[model samples]
Target: MAYQVLARKYRPQRFSDVAGQEHVTRTLLNALAQGRIAHGYIFSGHRGIGKTTIARILAMALNCRTAIGTEQRPTPEPCGVCESCTEIRAGNAVDVIEIDAATNRGIDEIRELRDAARYSPARDRYKIYILDEAHQITDAAFNALLKTLEEPPDHVIFMMATTQPEDFPQTIRSRCQHFSFHAVRFEEILTQLRTIAVEEDVIAEDAALALLAEAGDGSMRDALSIMDQAIASAPLDNGKARLDAEQIRELMGSVPNTVFERLMEAISENQSAPVIEEINRLINAGNSPSQLARQFVRYLRNALMARIAGENSELLQISPDERARAARSAMLFSEEDLTRFLQVMLRTFDELNYRQEQRFHLELGLLKLVHLQRLLPVEELLSQLPAPTAGKGSLGGGPLPGTLPRLQAAPAPARPAAPAQSPARPAAPARTEAPIAEPTRPAFSPFEADRDRKITSEATTPAAASAAPPAPQALTPIETAARAAETRATEATRTTETRATEKMQPAAVVGVAEPIAEGALALAAEADTAPEAAAGGSLDLDRIREAICAALEREGHNTATALLDAGDWKQSNGAIEVTLAIKKTMLALTMNAEADKICRNTLKQLGVGEKLVFLPGEASSAAAAARPRAAASGSVQAAAMENPLVRQAQELFRAEVRTVLDLRDRK
Candidate 1:
């Protein structure tokens, strides 16, 4: 008899025999017992995970005769002694027609199947069509079979299996019930391999069996195939099929724990020579490039895990000796160093699959890692450079808030191009005019020096009279610094605003540079609409009340209309108010000040102004005794202070307190 391949010989004959597919098997069995059988079905999974095998078993179940009587109906499991089961086992089941869709994927084949699907079963209870690799079928064939799949004969069932479900047409998929099988777990694969080894009477060590399991990569068919290879290669000195760890390791071409330890030691010392030697040894020992890459990635991963936990080696999947070696090696380097090595290994591993110069790529990766300690952390890198002297204002605050204290730029002599290296290897100091201190200055703002120069230059020279450094007599150093920063930020803001206005302004006005005529017309219209706009560059309060009234009235808001009509507005130093029937300070406080500004400006364009004075008609009983004005001002200040967006904008842009405008005023 011809030798049967392990894949076919160990093929799961029943649902119970199928490994690592309990959920799928149980669902199908229950469906069959409940008579909830669908006419068309699709089975999907990765290669060698039993997509075809499951489809075949499902076919056998559908056509099974010697049914086990249950409380409701017969279950999905078919009795092996039945004629239907015998025929299926022999691959000559009359009712269960198996088709290899890959080779026979034509419209003609599908048409013939479609024609045959209409007929009753030849002998069994159900006519089953099993198409393996159904995704390989041509588009024309799929289109031809779609109608039959959607509404097949009562006795005809289509079981289509494919490794690539995504490749199948959506229409065909929608017409069938779908089931996806996942890769078997490592434990499950190990259990199955052990059972097979025992059944084959091969004396295999647990470690040897585990090695075979790992080599299988979560596939039973793969596990069996690997086991067969091991069995064939096993020593038969005593006419016994016994396998030892040494034989398994030799056959697997796995680097021994000693070699791995040596490599680990080299990595920890940042020595490239020993690492290269190990790679060469592995290559000479017949380790495939892909396998070597996988091993390196695995080692890096295990090393990281071992480093983090600071415990025993049992947690890692690698051998106990390897884990111990990794733990020791992990102690030799920092997390950052290990991270760099992992990144290099990953890049090299990815390149191995595509690049012709595998050794060069791998060696280069190793060499780069050997020198990885030279690279500094991001913060260190930035702090090493002399920060630009008061660079343009950043949108968000520089770096993260509450980050590490800013490092003072070392005196040019001691500050080399590179940052302070690992303590063991201090960088050579640069030649400079000044002796470097041990970074004692607290948070040096590069802006401080520039601001000081600007101040001295302004105090002595007359060029900056218009720019106007505030009088030196009035301000302290810190206040002066704050003021300078604010002035610079404001000037930067004004420049950007000017550019934006230039872009948006009409060509004729743009040529005039300032657009004075348009500004005058806008100013006039604004003053007419919102009289308070004349006070500053923008609108004040009264116009906003009138605009709100108009808008609310247009929207059929009568209450708002009456309130606005009767409301009295008053204007003060920089604020305005409109009297309201009720006093809800909290509600009023919630109004966005920026949105109010936009509304006020918009109303000013319509020739409306004054200020929106909201007088509390029903004054609180404590108003006179407690000072309502002070309380109200405090509330508004508190509201602005609590606003995250406002606070962020104020701090980020260094906006100065110019004036606070109230939304109430009378014309």
Candidate 2:
């Protein structure tokens, strides 16, 4: 006899020997014990999952003659040594007929079997007909067997098996007892392999058997076949068969888990060089790029499952050590990153076969994975940005010197002292001193005022007028009186000259004096109310702007503060103006409203008036109408021509400036 492979040599001979599919086995055993066996039976499942084997066991149980304690009936558990059982196991039972439906699939063949079904058993208690791949039978053949299948003789049993049960017509399926099978579990497959290894005296490691079982992909037959191949091809050491994971990997053209770990680490670290080198090494070692991609996809899937389902997920078929390693690798990536990596590899696997340069494509895909952005939650990213300063308004303060030039305060006019009265003029109404008003405007220091006066006199006086300013050093009483009289006469002359100049420059003088007067009055009122204001502790325009910004930030109105930070602030006639570009109209409105309220409250607290105003970027319709058309057009053209690129294009094309359009003006 030819040497039998492990699959055939260890074929399940009894119902109890079958692993998994307990549903089918238990139902069949119960039916036999209660003598409730059906006339027709159908077994359906994936290949190598014990469909045909179960059918054979059922047949032997039906025909066995060896009784259990002289009961004159067949038993659920067949006596293997009995002639009927031995013959069925050997596939030579006279009463049992196993037909390959793939070859005998026509109506004529089914008709012949249907005719044979009418007769009684030749020897055994019952005649059994088992058809494999029963779905392959033609429609006409299924129709011919329908009547016989529906009501088979009591002494005959019809057993049909197919991997695809749905292909059979409903009319035929309804008449048979259907038993569905499922793929065997990993543990069952692994246990079976270990038992075979020990029984065969093959020196195989448990890890090697586990790998073989995983490679089987839920098929016991495939597992046994792979084990047989490994045992034969395994190199002998000290006259003993030796098999390990490395040898299995070499035979299967697979990379070890360690290789996958190394690749994952390199990708997480964004090291493209090591990734490229690893790929080259694998390719040089005879590993197919497409195969490696598929294995990597599997590895990532395992790691992802471990992350989501913990280390004890049934989906993860790896060992505890491998699970721990996978869990550690999973910690290096977020779920989004792992998912993206899987997607890229799976897509590359699909395209790998079509590409002419497989290695190039693989390298490109892996490189993309290496440079993929780290996945961070939106909340976390937002937390890293600088937070806005609280409770501050951008307006309310005066202009910042850093942003704009400083304004110089004009000097106040000095008052001359009254002359001492002699008894002769009868005390021309004792000179009354005007009450000093609190200074609203910032006052110029005496040093600054004196410096300005000197500068003014130097710039305005003629050489003759300047030279006559020397006074007599020592004098008698008459001389002192004469000197004072002469000095008064000269001052009167200078005053006459200044008044004439002031009249000539009335516009400049008036414009400068009005604001100074208003500021002075305000400062005096503030000083009278609070002594601190007199001491220069009162808040100024700049301080008000800073305080408003601080207030806005405290209220979580960061948007308003940011907009105001780049704004222009001005104070004219006691009114404060805040000018900002209106990029978003609604946002501008909201910010203005909030800022107005905050500015009012802050100014009230600082003893300032609540006169805040928002300046619109575009002129109103009435204002535009009031402007001269020619001047507006000229301004627009000037702005357009100011851009270098626009000017170059105009010169190149010898074009005149047409209408200038503002994109922001459009709806």
Candidate 3:
């Protein structure tokens, strides 16, 4: 006779022999021992989790003649040597009948079962029904069995086993006692496999067994099945099964971490040929694209774990050799880079299913892995770079001054050492002409100087005024005394002219501009004629805007349009409502307050009592109103030059390129 497969030969025969399901087994054993069994029991869990086997053991326990004869149905453990136990193990038990619910899912079949269930057990203490894949039963059959399940005969017991418990009707499920099982753990599966291997006198390395255990993924049956195949594929001598890790890997077509290490080394070194050659070699060795993708993902995961855990890597469940290889691979790639590679491999796996040629996908994925240094996200790539040569200005100007580049524990780019001292900022632009000379004659009398000093001292402390001296000039005692009466006028004109020049001049010139350089010019332009206005009134919107534009141009136009077109003047209740449009709500509030203060201060100088209301609107509206008046022509008129609605949408969304979605969803 041919040898029995390991799945069947090593199947769990007793409750204790089952792995990862002690809770379900212990409860059933207690019920059987105490004679508190329910009419129906439902066992549910993932595949290969001992659901069917538990159902069989329950059936045998119910019909055990030895226990019944001894009236010691007292012990929950079924004596496997008993006639009922032996028959059930052989799959030909009479009273303990196992039905494949998947095959016998018809209404008529269930009706026949219901009719037969009405009779007493034939030559047994109880009649046990084991329904496998019970969820696959037809709706009609489920309805027919529902009534019987709720009120079955005292001797009849129903055990339904299904991977999907939710598929059954709630009524049917409520009538049954539910038992949930969990997938076997890797360590538990490995321990069990080791025991079986030793018992069978199989010679195998622990590493080889570990690989089998991981592939099992909490499935004892699957692990045993793979082990059996490995044994058969091994070189046999004197009827003894023997195998090594290499042979197991070869048979399973699993490329070890060494392959991953090589690929990573090639990637780090920027060599594509090795990875390409390896891909071809793997293809020749019969590895499919999907399988390769899975292997790549596994390697990537190991690499990431190694990178995070570093030397303290006791947390990982990998072999020592694999851990060492992982450590090496981790040194070559960042966790983020590995994560990106894993993500791409997953996508490659999906693409493989749709690709007419799978090799192409696998090769492409491998090539991507080899060239990962170039494919990493910009942030991640920057993290891998060395502290940016201190203002050598990275290939793309590193993070702005005083700001550190974000890092993520990735390998930084290899670069030369930077100076200990930080690089200096560029010098300001050169002065075009010689400095202007101060007047030799006094501009004020001694009394005027004293009054001016008194006024400055009254507004602020004497120390502050002394620290910031006014323009230099010689003065007579009498002229200085007279200057005291005109101190307010002189100071007011000085402040006004200083502001005008600062606003209208470039930043480079603002620092050195003299008080008298443009004071006369500014005063002429702003001379007030309205009797209600102050004699020195100089407040104007055009002058302020021009000043601001000049001050900002020296820095850059980056925010010129945004600042200018971000405000609008609206007529509201006989007052000018200055509505500022800004993308950021906080910025809008800030600009509105600043504009109100500036307008009020300037208006006070102009002798205006009206309060300025700084409101806020969409920035796009301001942009529309600010556009230059265009000559209406054939295409220009048709194009609707600077429409307020479209400009509003563009500014609000910050998207210059408009699409149909933008037009259709305007608020």
**Candidate 1 lDDT trough over 10 residues, lowest sum:** 510-519
Tell me model 3's lDDT, rounded to 2 decimals: 0.63
lDDT of 2 by residue, 1-667 (tens): 9999999999998888898889999999998888898989999988898999999999988888876534543456887888899999999999999999999999999999989988999899999999999999999999999888888889889899998999999999999889999888888998898898888878898789888988888889998998888888899978778889888888888888888899988987668899999999999989999899988888899999988888789878766667887887787777777888889988888889899898988998999787664333345435534443311111123221112211111111222223323323321121112222233432223323323222223445688557776533333223333344334334433443444545542211100011121111011111112344334443365566667766775555554554444356666644555554332222223343345456545655777542444442432334323321221334333565576865575566554332232333334
Query: Quick one: best lDDT, which candidate?
Result: 2
Across 12-89, the per-residue lDDT of candidate 1 in tens digits comes to 888888888888999999987888999888998877788778887887777777665853225568766678887897
lDDT ranking, best first: 2, 3, 1
The RMSD (Cα, Å) of candidate 3 is 20.1
Task: Estimate every model's Cα lDDT from 0 to 1.
Answer: 0.61, 0.67, 0.63
Which candidate has the highest TM-score of all?
3
TM-score of every candidate relative to the true structure: 0.56, 0.57, 0.58
Tens-digit lDDT string for candidate 3 (1-667)? 8888888888888888888899998998888877898999999988887999998888778777676436544367777888888989999877887899999999999999999999998777889999999999998899999999999999999999999999999999999999988988777888888998998899888989988987786788888988988988898768887878888888887877677778878876667899889888888888776777787777777778889987447544566667787787787666677787778888888898889999988878877765566542556334534452322111133432222332211222111111111113322233423233332444433333333322222347777767776855545433343343234234434554545555553222211112232111110111223433223333454444434433333233323223443355443333333443432222222333233233334444554432333333354553545643232244222243255654564466443311111112324
Off by over 4 Å in 2: 68-75, 371-667
